[model samples]
Target: MTRETLDRQLHHIQDEILLLGSLVEQAMLNAVQSLKNRDRAAAHKIYQADQDINEKRFAIENAILILMATQQPMARDLRMLAAMLEVNTELERMGDYAKGIAKVTQRLGDVEIKIPIQEIEQMASIATSMLHRALGCFISENAMVASQIPAEDDQVDRLYEEIYRQIVHTMIENPDLIDHTNLLLWVAHNLERMADRVTNICERTVFINTGELLEMDTTDDEEELDSE
Candidate 1:
């Protein structure tokens, strides 16, 4: 009920959010490493990291629940708590998406095959940086930076589309590589989704800062950019 208690709760939630961010970064790194070196153990560790994300999500939700029940947070406080809920959910899904990529890596490890890992690594690096920026925007309370996340995600989307085309081409040309190529294609899809979820967190951050949700549309991004 006291201001001190509320501040403490907010601080605790912030810490949880940061920890979630760290888990996300680790997941991306380990997943890419799995693909690069065919490291099954690294993939397994990435999979295991998902548990930490889930636990952090639970902890954040619990904190929010307690704050609402006891602190009676309203107005901006209510907005913050709601955004925190959305942020944690997005982060959880992103973590799962990362695990999905890692799972594909683990599967490829059993077979004696290799695919172009660099494209995926490049995608991962850019997407991870976008996620890192979203995390930074939240911590700095920068609505402008948060709102710009969708534009940053466009890069990842383009890379995903490119990779998808290459994978489909490779599969069509060499039907024997269909299974492996499809696996890599699915991994790119998962990473794209992860980038999307990271963008969602930024939208939530913008909402927290300005009290409005701005949904970004990628459908006409090309035309929109050309006109601009």
Candidate 2:
């Protein structure tokens, strides 16, 4: 392919990645809303949308692979291709987390139990926001913004901790709510994991911009600081 054609294909792949990001964000939102509102139809919708997310991801990956094989991209172009592949995988996994939350919702069924899901909702909010910003950084190739995105994961982690402790206490206080609380905890865990996948996308953004495969292990540093 010509240079212009190659660049156009790369841009197309980037656009598809952004599209997938938006779908995953919607899935996360719907999954959380389904849980919060006890809407089975909404939960099922997320599960169905996950199929589209998976299909789109594979299509983009195949396009990138073909471009790489036929064009023999230079170092910079190769970096972008590699970043796209990694980010595509992360986005797909985030979609899976959303599906996982949907499954939890299905398991909950029509139980009229009222347990506070506000913290899980907060976790989902932060995670989806991180995902949105990460995609923007990816599209803009902004290493600085990408580098800062993982820091927000710290807030998600804290919310996860709070949810975990609260759920455990609730389960302890009311053994009957053990199943309900456990399911909600799993939902929170899925949202937390989705945020972690967004960090992976941010790392890919940094890699594409700087051509450096740096591991942004901020959680370890945060733990140490907490200990100190």
Candidate 3:
């Protein structure tokens, strides 16, 4: 294949990845909103939308595989192709997390409980923003933006901790709310994990630019240090 053709295919892959990101972002936002409004229909819709995200992801991966086999990309170009593959997988998993949140919303449909949702909502917001920024970094091949993206994960972690404590306290005080609160906890956990997946995407950005894979979870490091 000619270099020009390879470049065109790579650009197409980038566009498809961004398209997948947008769909997943919408899924997460809808899931959180559905839980807040107790809107079963909205939650179910997010679940249905995940099917499209999955299909798009498979198509992008197949295109990347074809390029890798036929183009024989070398050095930085090969690193980029590999990063796209990994980022594609991470994006798909992030979509699954969103779907998981939507499922929790469906399960809690009209249960009439007073579980706090603000922190979980905030977590989802930060996660989706991280994903958006990470994708920008991916498209621009900007390692600087990628390096900064993981710091945002720390905010999501703090929100997750707050939500967990609040839910546990509520569950303890009102034993009847245990089941519903547990489901909310699962939703928060899924959002937190999704934020982590965004960090993985950021790592892929750095990998694509610098050809180096770095772990960017400094929040865990600080926690361990404080415990010590």
Candidate 4:
């Protein structure tokens, strides 16, 4: 393929990745909203829509592989295509986390457990925002911006801990609600994990730009500072 044609195909694939990101972002937000509202129908819709996320993921994968095979992308272009592949996988996993939240909502049924809705919503909000910025950094090849996004995962972690403590306290107060409370904890865990995966996408952005595979761990940074 000519350079012009290759560039065009690359742009098309990037657009697909953005579309996939938007879908997963919506799924994450909708899943939590469904839980807050106790809307089983909405939760079920999110679960079913996971199939569409899966399909989009594979479609992006197929396109990338075809480009690699036919275009024989070299150096920076090859790194980019490879990073896109990884980002595509990470986005699909985030979609699964969303689906997992929806599943938890379904399992809760009609149980009247006291959910930490505010904290949970806050976690989702921060996570989706991180994801949005991560994708933007990826498209711009802005390693500087990508480097800063993972630090926001610290906020997600603190919220997850607060949610966990609240749930545990509630479970202890009412032993009978253990099962229902555990499901709520699972939802928080899903959101936390989704935010962690966004850091991985950020790592990919840095990789594509500098050819360096850095882990970007904020927790470790904190530990080092404390030791110093």
Name the candidate that leads on lDDT: 4
Q: Model 2, residue 77: displacement in angstroms?
A: 0.5
Q: TM-scores of all models?
A: 0.91, 0.93, 0.94, 0.95
Q: State the displacement of the C-alpha of residue 74, model 3, in Å, after optimal TM-score superposition.
A: 0.8
Q: Which residue pairs collide, candidate 2? A: none
**In model 2, where do residues sit more than 4 Å from their true spots?**
221-228
Shift of residue 124 alpha carbon in model 2, Å: 1.1
> What is the clash tally of candidate 3?
0
Misplaced by over 4 Å in model 3 are 221-228
* Residue-level lDDT tens digits of model 1 in 1-228: 558888888888888888888888888778888888878888899877999889888988998899899989877788888888988888888888788888887877667655667788888998888888888888677888778787877788778878877887888888887888789988888888878887788877788878888886455768868964
What's the CA RMSD for each of the models?
A: 3.3, 2.3, 2.0, 2.8
- Over 17-120, each residue of candidate 4 has an lDDT whose tens digit, in order, gives 99999999999999999999999999999977899999999999999999999999998999999999999999999999999999988999888789999999
Please, what are the lDDT tens digits per residue for candidate 3 over residues 115-135?
677787788888999999889
Model 1's number of clashes is 0
Whole-model lDDT values for every prediction = 0.82, 0.87, 0.87, 0.93
- Model 1 RMSD in Å is 3.3
* Model 4 CA deviation exceeding 4 Å by range: 221-228
Clashing pairs in 1: none
